[model samples]
Target: MFSATLRSRAASSASLQSRSLATAAAPSSSSSGEPLTHYRITLRRSAIALPMNIKGTLAALGIHRRLQTVFHRHTPDIAGKILTIKELVTVENVPESAVRTKWEQRQERKASRGYEVAGSKLGAEP
Candidate 1:
């Protein structure tokens, strides 16, 4: 019984991956000279209450929290994982230059202060 279930899940994931890749490849191939090399995947929905396999797939993609974003090179394996939990996440094709590290993502999320400091308080001769 367990083997049958696993086979069905694998089949579904494979089919979904093919369909998604076909659709995704169409526009990029015709639209630009530069190819998109990375996938910007964001966890839009929580995996809570979902099947353990679904949660595991998300973990495999390096997404542990809702709204978290991770970048991965465009590959068949990654595409399969994305398709498995397609409803729980959002995917975008990005150029290699757009890929950012975890620290870079955090830095981009931070807001800049409105004013710049002319001098530090410690610089004053009291």
Candidate 2:
């Protein structure tokens, strides 16, 4: 019984990898034609020296390093991949418009510059 269970788990993980790749390559909306949702997956932990499979999965998810986030359209294959590396990352659903580019994310992280004064450096003296 243990062997059977192990075999099944291995087979499922293998198939999941393939399916995740396919989904990440090209995504399709449902039959209803409504826009598909997206998942913003961010790598919270590094896959360094862990295992080749885990590293590959991060690459497949478009996450290269820690705290790097990537958005992917919602799909079963992507979901499977997320599940495989769930411990190393975080996931959230967001509309397409909510997705921000790398530059945008950086800008958002930066502390806002305080209001600038047009006439500064020289104060009125009586």
Candidate 3:
């Protein structure tokens, strides 16, 4: 049991290291450094003691936890939601091109599998 905890701690540290490397390799700014087109929203604070309307505002924005990030296009509805919970989150405008889906962000954080598979025969027709 002690060994398992150590292994998990090691793995988590490795992942943190790799995530830092990924950010260092490519900066997100555009070549021209022009203004971004979409809002890069991050939940910076929790709504624990806030009113139900405030909590609902966070949910409407797709924020699930403290520090959780979600992006959205610049629209009236989104702007209103952001304004409603302006105290709880931080917002930045990022280029539409820079926005990434949850899956894409996951791929960035994932460590590459060390081994490559040449082919699989399990799905072969009989």
Candidate 4:
């Protein structure tokens, strides 16, 4: 058990080191020398209930029901669509890497909790 814990700690440290290196290596700005800003848009609600025109806008932004898409830099077209369906998309300005990592962590936590609940329910069923 001690060896297993040590191995897990080592692996976790290695992963974090690699992530930091990758982030450090990333270019800080675009070709135009402007700071590359990115936004993470998560579709919390389904836009299927909306009309075709609004749905088209959502699709154009690469957002579907319960999906998330990250856009680099703010474009007028994107901003317009976001404004049009402000209620459907939850937008946040964050580094793309950070956004992805945060979503993955959230998913992992949710999955672990779901499995724990399911396991407890099964054990009680008998």
Highest lDDT model number: 1
Residue-level lDDT tens digits of model 2 in 10-54:
977776777645434333421245354888888988888788988
Poorest 10 consecutive residues by lDDT, candidate 3? 22-31
Model 4 agreement with the true structure over 1-126: per-residue lDDT tens digits: 999999989977776776645433344421245344565677878876679988898788776557665454567777787888788767755444444444665575574443334344554756
Model number with the top TM-score: 1
Error of 2 at 18 (Å): 34
lDDT of 2 at 67: 89
Off by over 4 Å in 3: 1-35, 115-126
Cα lDDT tens digits, model 1, 9-40, are: 99777767777575465446434567788888
Residue pairs clashing in model 2 are none
The runs of at least 3 residues in candidate 2 whose Cα sits more than 4 Å from the true structure, single-residue gaps closed, are: 1-36, 115-126
Winner of 1 and 4 under lDDT: 1
The C-alpha TM-scores of every prediction are 0.66, 0.58, 0.63, 0.46
Better of 3 and 4 by TM-score: 3
Query: Which run of 10 residues does model 4 get worst, by summed lDDT?
Result: 22-31
Task: State, as a TM-score between 0 and 1, how close model 2 is to the true structure.
Answer: 0.58
Superposition TM-score, candidate 1 onto the true structure: 0.66
